[model samples]
Target: MVSIGLKGLRHLDQKPTLSKANRNSFTNEYWKGVRVKFIIQAAAGGISFMLLFLACSCYLYGSLYKSHQRYHNFRILAVDYDGGVIGKALSAAYEELKRPEFPTLYFHSPEDFPTPSDVYQIVRNGHYWGAIYSTKGASDRLEAGIQGGQAATVYNPNDALYWVWNQQYYTTFAQSVVEASIEQLVSAARAAYTKINGTQAFPYVAQSDPDAVQAFLNPIAATVANVEVDAQDSVFLFTSISMVMPVLQQFFFLLALNGVSREHQLYSKMSVRSSMIIRGVAGLLYTFGAALTQAGYYWAFRDGWKVDGNQFVLTWMVLWLLMHTHFTYLDAISAITPISRMPFAVLTWIFLNISTTISPLELQPGFYYWGICLPASNAYSVLVTIWSGGGDNRLYRALPIMFAWWIVGNLLSMAAHLRACHLAYKFDKEQQNNKGDGESAMGMTPVGSEVTIRPHSTNESAAHDDLQQDKTLEEQDLEQRQIYGPSIPPPFA
Candidate 1:
């Protein structure tokens, strides 16, 4: 009852209308200095921070995984079971496999057989992805039925151990050698049969019956003709850069907004002030634009690194516009919480933690899509298109989805920011009156008046001001005590 009565009397303590107008004029004068200072400070700090981030990013990505490249030469060991003739044939076949650039090859005679377990262990420990083993069972089968015998047996490590690049060529070369051997044996058998009979022997069917030949050859031909590997090498790097760049950019926006929310907390009436609103929006846009420009420049100059530059640029622009707008909306949510900074900081950290999988757009789609929906996901998509030779069609298809997400996220954020701003200001006069004073006729410094408005930035004075609001309340107490006989009684007490 006493607090309510005091609150009722507090409004009667407001400054008269004429003095209020004069104070307004003074406040305008005070803020001209404030605006000029803030504009300079914000512009300087924003540019400095952006450049530093860009420089660091460029240094990190410029080499593009050069450290993992394998330059040391290595050798492959081959074991031959056949005598000199078969051995020579095997050697020729091995050499053929090694052609177009041999790493190194060492041939071992058949008698020096390593046990199967030892062979497996050696291959595993030897850093060798390839090895071939022949067995006597294959030779005996061939001798028993020269024209219809099983081909020589060769054992290899698990398919996972196969060298990705050499798998197809190696298979083709091995089949060709088997066919040549079969043909030689069959020809010798036909000659021997004719020599014994003194004329031609009964006709034997060929392995290349037309129907069988077509069934085997047709699909293989189509597969080779239709399957394409039209990938550029730099797609991986470009996608990587894209995935990480958005995360860095969003982090800057989140932190900067946290600072803005702090400023609003410092002065209550400033929430509804049009100037504050404009500056808040403008500052956010400026930072967002700066980050976007840096990302775009990196994208454009990426050179033959990625294709579809213009498409990527368009997609990215629409996507970021949505993202920054959504961030503006989220500003309110951050401000209303007791510790607004913590949520944004933690969320940004979480997004970054999950962003690694999509860090490069050029990765195979199977891997890229796994974690691509994270903040870096869209950026990775745009980058992959550029790196993998996509263009306008892909951008047109993708940007709408990104734009929709951006819109939805911003809408939620904006609603929260606006409501929080309103609530923060609503308690301004109440909080002020609750201090050691009844209330000033002027009401919490009328925001811009008497308040030394700095640039909407956090500097030493601002930090000090944050902890120093009691001085403003002190002045109000002195004025109230002089006029009202000190009945104010420390409003809380």
Candidate 2:
């Protein structure tokens, strides 16, 4: 049945010319074209690009946090009453917090007693995230678990748990350090108290009396309340901004390959006048269209995505349009000198394949040229700057580079158009010249008069020959005149 149907269809159908097939194929072709353009744009700077951007941002965010933590972690300032053993123990505890694994710990020794005001000033200056001040006998009090006795005082500049915990840990660790340091002093004090008053030996473990510890540590540990400090995500913002390079590169590649190439091929045969106007209009329309599409989707899903919709939308739109403009200009050029297409295509692919740095400019400084020269590189940098938010500085700084590509592209397009036109003119002239030569060669001149002359004859024989030739010419001219009217002159006349 299938074979029968196929035979019937084939028999019924008459094959059409290639031109007709093209016209029939236009509808699907247009949609396919649009899809290709979209794909290129998306691939250049689309979801994958965004994901890469996000990944870089996330990576940079983590890095920034590490840097921030390096400077602003936990801090400790201790004053001890028992010689300096208690202070040494507190310092040792603070030193333990300084290891890289520790989140945020800073230790400081103040000439004057550490105060809430001092911590506030430091935190306000954005130096320290949290601060801690330790008092002497604070450890002894912790052992007792008692309420109101002389408690080793801990002052928190920033209400960070690390400091509070540090005060606790400091007390524990310091108590151990102090216990080891002042074993002789403590032993002497206990033995003196026992021998002088006739009491028993000091207990195996050090005494853990809160009130007693407080009394002993008090003057040394100034009474200060907790001061809460808020930390800003400066690092996250910075990291996020740094990831824009990848996004820009992705976008540029899409624009150059899909959008530019497609448009160029489509309008390849259009009149120069129409082509220029249509190209400009189409570029503007598509750019705005792309921007609006992205803006609308982003606005709807911004919150869920944890990005600033309004800013993101605006940036996305601007970057999208900029990329479209770049692509359109490139298309114009590609249309003119299609010979350059292969090179342009290869370079575009390379740019897309290259990995963008987290802070490309900041890291290498030299890569700026490579990033700026290529369409994908420029687009990636622009997108990263726009999407990430922090690199507005870098973006603005890099503006000239981006602008340069656009200008150069537009110039190339103009040059290509001129070149195409010049080539076309030369071709037309050559054709016209060839046609004229062919026409001149095919045209005829009369056979006898000026074109072919009878030679002068001497004697009676030559006269007879001349008369015969003249008679022939007369006959031929008569026939020519009869057929073509009086246009041929009569030889006899």
Candidate 3:
């Protein structure tokens, strides 16, 4: 409440009002400062964008640059049980093709693996990318067939070369690169075999047994079996950088979470821990819905692109964990990173994480080896395993990394949230203190002719003059009410 003596009340009606020109004496100076600041900010923005472009190029392109140079990282085991010509030829053929860009085939004796099932286990267990094996008596069967007798009628050509690989492990890569390379390998091996046997078999090539004739012609018919068929070309989008799209969408979710908290002053009203918990719980719930939506796309698009799933529940769980990993980490970033700079931070994070997942770790440079530890890469590994029906089964390996990201992101976010809360509480207290000071000062400070103003952002001192003016009329009304009866409020009015 403002109190005014009779003398002050009489003079209040006579107070002077400043003209528009006089109201802001330094308008030119303020506008000039704004213009200068705008120019500086514009220059800074251009430079920042240029830097971001350069930095993100390295993040996005690092793995892709000379990607094939590291392809020897894919290990293939070559085992020969036949211990004969075709096996020797295939081994030699594989060696001839063993460039740095191609998967290297390590030759192993039949003694190393008890049976073909052992090779299958090696492939399935992902100890190696694939295996080339000649079954027992492969050369013997082909030899008997070539000789042309009773053996010629019943001889099987497929018994020669068998390729054990799970195309489901990386369908696109297998089809485009691995399969093509395998075809070349088989062709070369066949040619090598024909060169050696063509002269010997030509005289006996007149055999009437069609099965044996076919076997003699193409003795090594390499058959590749997909341990689990994952031929879907559409999974590329879900496997690559596109997979992180939904994760990137969480920036807006974070913005919305912040908008409400800021507008409603939710953080200011609650204890620090409670406010952060609300944010976490809200983010988790939102991520749950997002995960379901992603999983639904995986299901809904099955017929269109096909990643057949009885794995819906597991898919949803993976998506939930994956998206939440992004959310919690981004939330922590936003806690420290200003909203204006968050786009850069987000872009950099997305590019960095997605780069690690673009190709097989072997195809990427060693510098990117550690990137597999990134949450997005780990999430992708797990998702691919799920999509392939556990083909490349990196589940146990990737889960721990994803969990580690969650733990670190939450811990960092909690610390940042506490700091932010402390600052907010401190600011609120300062505002309350300043408000009390302003109210106290006004009661003693002379107004109108003797008033003084100071420009301080947090202090409300500049508004004291306007506040005093508003109180003038209220003070007059109070004086009249005290002096007159309620019915005879004013003299004639």
- What TM-score, over all chains together, does every model reach? 0.37, 0.38, 0.80
Stretches off by above 4 angstroms in model 2 are 1-275, 294-303, 306-309, 332-354, 357-392, 429-493
Per-residue lDDT value at 23 in model 3: 50
- TM-score order, best first, reads 3, 2, 1
lDDT-wise, the better of 2 and 3 is 3
Writing each residue's lDDT as its tens digit, candidate 2 over 182-286 gives 222223332332343222212322246544333333212223332321122232322233233333433344344334423333223446667556655655566
Model 1 C-alpha lDDT per residue in residues 371-393, reported as the tens digit of each score: 43444454444543443334212
Give the true-structure RMSD of model 3: 13.4
Question: Global CA lDDT of candidate 1, please?
Answer: 0.40
Candidate with better TM-score, 1 vs 2: 2
The model with the greater lDDT, 1 or 3, is 3
Best by lDDT: 3
Q: For model 3, name the residue pairs that clash.
A: none
Give the alpha-carbon lDDT of every model.
Answer: 0.40, 0.40, 0.73
The list of candidate 1 runs beyond 4 A from truth reads: 1-237, 257-267, 270-280, 299-303, 306-312, 315-319, 322-333, 336-375, 386-397, 435-493
